[model samples]
Target: MQYLESFYNYLQYERRNSSHTIVAYKNDLRQFCEFLEQENIELWVNVTSKVIRSWMVQLVNEGVSPRTVTRKISTLKVLFKFLMLEDVVDSNVAKHVITPKIPKKLPAFVKETEMDFLLDSIEFGQDFTGLRDKLIIEIFYHTGMRLSELVGLMDCQIDAGNDVFKIYGKRSKERIVPIIKELKVSLVRYLNERDKLFPEKRNPYLLITEKGLPVYHKLVYRVVNSYLGQVSTVVKKSPHVIRHTFATALLNRGADLNAIKELLGHSNLAATEIYTHNTFEKLNSIYKQAHPRAEKMEDYI
Candidate 1:
């Protein structure tokens, strides 16, 4: 547990990881610690391959997704590796523990036509809240910002003249995403309304509620969900889905994967590669439709 505390401190201060990522790692480690405690195991040296595998099986039995179990295994492996580096443990039992294979899932996205209708129908003049929500949706779709990065946005981070906004991503890393021309126009319109709502305050957030308070995560989620529900019948209509829509749309239009990775603030290409599957599906459909020999000849026979 003491080592966990140290790891938390390392993540917060030294690694400068985002609070969300730190929380996830902390939770994963906590679950592992609780499992060990229940079995009367203490100290990193007491961890064994069999105990690790059993914990994984228990998680699966409790209906945890294979992806989640894999992540937990990764968390433990990293923790023990750190301990081994510090000579806190005699061996890395977690090293020999294998992660369960997870099936690749396609990223969900709204159709471009549907997204256009949703954005166009938003009545920005209805109220300050309406204006704010409109801009929020536009930014999410245009910029592909993670929810945390979008919520963490400050007013000073935007360089409107350059059409770019700075974001603080995971690990407190900084990246600049360019604003599309349409988004810039929409943002300027929102700013006009925002100024009327908060005439005197100097808060740095671009989006705020009617009370001039910076937007919170749940509020953003609700706004995204409500608007997406109007345009989509899909069960999972959230901000991340909008972000996915943005990525897939770009990839479909021939944007470079590496460029998209940077824009989306992905730490690795693997994280960004999911969109390729969507692109591949699109290509396959086109091939089936346009290729003369693509159709089966058995129907004619």
Candidate 2:
């Protein structure tokens, strides 16, 4: 509680973390602080490794997922590290705490054929809303950008001459994502239609509502979910699904992991490596179908 505000300011201004991240950190710290209060602890220095582990055990007993528990532990590490830098604590108590191991869940992606059907067979109509919706979906799958990046995309950020998008990803990190010719064509058409539909609107964002205001997160989510549901039975049909589809599609086509990491604006290659699991599944399926000995071996097993 003492240096919490200072830590938040450090995350916001010094680390340049997104507001979403800041809020998550805040919530995690609040929950930890509440746990401390229950233990009758009043100061940062009073927190111990044992108490932190006990709080973690309580969270698990309360049915929190291991993945979420890991994130909360990460929040504690950052908090105590900040506390040490500010001389609030002599040593970091959370540094040695063992966190729950998260299960490796493969990222879900839309099948290439299903994506093809949605774009090629689906008739989104010629109205402003329909055009906007189609373009939104195209951008998501083409760019592999996160929802916030797409929502905050500015017209000036699109480099038509270079056939690339200047995307501001998590923590305001910038990356250039190149576009294919087909996507370039779709983008040009959408920009023209957007201008014609809202001629006088001065919004700088690339995507906007029929009311000429910048499009919000829910609007984008609905557009992706509605279209993806028709083609993909994937339980989660959000914008991030399309982002997954984009990454998997690239990996399937032999795109380099490092290249994909750059395009997706991931800070490290480990985040991009998850797509390889999906690619491996695809190859395994193809092997089962194409290799004569594969099916025979499977039957023997």
**Which candidate gets the maximum lDDT versus the true structure?**
2
Model 1 C-alpha lDDT per residue in residues 149-178, reported as the tens digit of each score: 888898899997888999889999888999
Q: Quick one: how many clashes does candidate 2 have?
A: 0
lDDT of 2 at 270: 93
Any idea what lDDT model 2 has? Answer: 0.91
Total clashing pairs for each candidate: 1, 0
> In candidate 1, residue 122 scores what lDDT?
49
lDDT of 2 by residue, 201-251 (tens): 787888898889999999899889999989889999999999999999999
User: Would you give me the overall lDDT of model 1?
Assistant: 0.88
In order of appearance, the predictions have TM-scores of 0.68, 0.69
lDDT measured at residue 50 in model 2 versus the true structure, 0 to 100? 97
Q: Single out the weakest 10-residue window by summed lDDT for candidate 1.
A: 121-130
Off by over 4 Å in 2: 1-101, 299-301
